[model samples]
Each structure stands twice: as C-alpha cells, then as structure tokens.
Target: CIILQIIPSFGLPAGLFLVLLIGIDRLLSVYFPIFYKFKNVRRYLMYHGLAIICYALLQYSFAYVYFEDRNVICGPPEIYQGKAKALWGSLSFTVIILSVILYYAVWRKLKNTPSMANDHRLFRSILAIMGVLILGWLLTITMFVLVVFLLDWRGLFSNIHLQSL
Candidate 1:
C-alpha cells in the first residue's frame, strides 16, 4: 500500500515532465524548423529522461518528509495535505500552464503557414487530447484546494464512517 502511494509521487511528476518535453519539442519543431530538422533527437530525449528522473526524485523527497507514519491505504486524505501537497499541486500546475502556452504557440505558427494545411487535422486531435488532460488536472487541483480549505480532515473520516454504517 505504501509503495502504491509512493510510486505516484515519483510517477506523477515524471509524467508531467514528459508532457512538458513534448510541448517543448513541438514548439521547437514549429518555431525553429531548420534547427530542429538537424538536431540530435536521441540525445535530447536522453537528456529529457535524466531531467525527469531528477525532478521525480526531488518530488519524492518532499513526499517522504510527510510520509513518516501516515496511513495511505485509506485514501488521499493522508497523502494529499500540508506543504508537500501544496508544492506538488503548484509544480504540476506550472507544468500544465507551460504546456498550454507552448502548444498554443505551436498552433499559431502552424496556422500561419500556408503550406501546412494538411497538418491541421493532426494538430486538432492533439489539441483535443491535451484539452482533456488539462481539464483533468484542473479538476484535481480544485479538489485539492477544496480539501485543504473547506473540508475538516478530522471530521471527514467520522462522516465517512457514519455514512458507511
């Protein structure tokens, strides 16, 4: 159970970093086509992987501090609280925002190119996928904010127990 909970602490940021990297790749391909064409993508991908691992480890360290004696099997009530949760949410939000900006820039550049008309369908599909992803993250962020500000952590468990009975 602990492993299940801890894995996401590492995986979540790693996944977000990958999305950010994808956005960066798209931005570069569109904004600097000549440079991007000859770039060593394999090397850049390796660098991206390393950077993701480092960031995930850093995120996991923050989680480890609050994980001393917490019971994670119950739900996010134990995992998503305090400074660690705040820091994670903020970092994830920043990544999402940056991705949105990068993708938008790519879209604008592609739209302005008269010869790239055939790529619109592909770009639209990508936009739809990204839209859903961003919406899910927005919902998650809202849930965290509500849990932190509106819900009383102690009372929450009691209410769940009462309702279950």
Candidate 2:
C-alpha cells in the first residue's frame, strides 16, 4: 500500500518518457520523410538517444518536483491529477492508435512493393519490436492500475468498516 503511493512518484514519469519517445519515433517516420536520408545511421541513432535522455530528464523532474516528498506519501492533486492521468492515458492510447496505423501502412506498402522482399524482413523486425513494446507497456499499465485500484478499494472498505463500528 505504502509503496503504491510512492511508486508513481517515479513510475509515471518513466512511463511517460517512454511513451514520448515512441511518439517521436512514430512522428518522424510519418512526417519526416528525410529522417534517415543522411546515410548517417549513426546520427539517426544519436538523435534517438538524445530523445531518450530528454525523456529521462523530464520524467525525473516531473516525479521529484511534482509528486515526491519527504513524508513518503503518494498522491496527486484532486484536479490536476486528472490532468496528469489524462496525459498518460491519452498518450498511451495514441501510441496504440499509431501502432495500428503503422502496421497497416507498412503492410499496405509492402504488399504494393512486392519486389522489395528484403524490405519485408526489415518490416518483420519492426513489427516484432513494436508488438513487444506494446505488450510490455500494456502489462505494465495493467499491473499498476490494478494494484492502485485494489489498494484503494481496500482502503475504502477499511474506512467503511471503521465507520460502521
């Protein structure tokens, strides 16, 4: 119970960072046609690496400055918490949406360009990675959400019993 309260002090930010990174990657793929055109795969990777570091910094800042305290409490403001929650929920779902779009787009293009057989191998790898990423995140979200809800339910039940007594 106690840890649950403290966890989002770190977890939400980390998760958000990942969500953001994935979002950026998708954005680049969709909108930035020249994204990998420089022939410098290393630079592409470096930029991606920078995005990750940016996420880490922002995540830590959000956790420490907004959520954490010395008293080991875990909570967000009644109103603002909703906003924060919405941001994450929305971001995650958007990623899922983009995943669907990407899958379809890739499939469609590959189907149209049958001569690019080697490209299919690359597509398979990308799909596999994306699938794994999605599953991992879903599991993580489910675990955290369930834990939080159950703890809250227990707390609520305890309070109810105390009041009844």
Candidate 3:
C-alpha cells in the first residue's frame, strides 16, 4: 500500500506539471518564434525539470511524514486522513482547472489564424492530449473521493478481492 500510494502521490503532480510545461513551450513557439528558436531551450528545460523534481520531492516528503505507516497499516493514520484527502483533492482540481484554461487559451489563439496543415495537426494532437489527461485525472480524482469519503474501504477491498477470483 505504501508503494502504491507513494508512486501515484509523486507521479500525478509530476505528470500535471509536465503538461503545463508543454503548454508553455507551445505558447512560446507560437508567439515568439524567433526568440524561441534562438533561446537556449536546454537551460529552460533544465530549470523546469528541476522545479518539477523539487515539487515531487516535497509532495513525497509530505506523504512520508503524514500518510505512510508500517506499524498499523500501509496507509495514512486516522488522524491524517482528512489532510491527505484534502491535499490530493485540491491538487487534482488545480491540475484540471489549469489544463482547461491552457487549452482554451491555445484554442482561442489558433482559431483566427490561418495555419499550415502541419500546424493544424499539431494543434489537434495537443488538444487530444489535453483531453485525455483531463479525463484520466478526473476519473482518478473521482475514485479517490469516492473511496475516501463515500464508501467503506474495508468492505470495498473485500468485495474487490472476492470478485477477482
């Protein structure tokens, strides 16, 4: 359970951050083509990469301190339950909202412009990627909320194990 919880706790945020970085990169390429071409992309990428790493580390540290427990169970203690739920819920919402906003801005920017076939294809691909990300994360968030708030986990786990056979 600790391994399961820890992996997603680090991965979800990092994935969202990577999406945001991609959006920013696309915006830069579209709006500042010359500067974007001349800029040291590696430096910018390194900085953003480091920031994402730091953010993941911080999240992992929080989970380690407040959520992980080997003595009782491989999950958060009862005292930290609310905090853990709130933390993940808020992070999910934040990612969803930001992705929507970024996608909207990109769509609006490209709507009036006459673009080459390649550009249009790229735009469509980006839109699809964002759509998939939002859907997947939304489903994950819903499950987390349902499991944490709406259902009894003891029974849920039992039913899941029974059905797996």
Which candidate leads in TM-score?
1
Give residue 113's lDDT in candidate 1 (0 to 100). 79
lDDT of 3 by residue, 1-165 (tens): 656566666676788777877777777777777988999878988988997888777656556566634354444222234465566566656766676777777777787678898998989888887778877877877777676767766787788899999
lDDT of 2: 0.53
Q: What TM-score would each prediction reach against the true structure?
A: 0.78, 0.51, 0.71
Q: Write the per-residue lDDT of candidate 1 for residues 1-165, one digit (tens) a residue.
A: 335667666677788778778888888877888999998979988998999999888777666665656545644334544587777677777787888788888888877876655677877788778767877876776687676657778887788999999
What pairs collide in candidate 3?
none
Q: Assess candidate 2 and give its TM-score to the true structure.
A: 0.51
- Give each model's whole-structure lDDT: 0.74, 0.53, 0.70
Clashes of 1: 0
TM-score of 3: 0.71
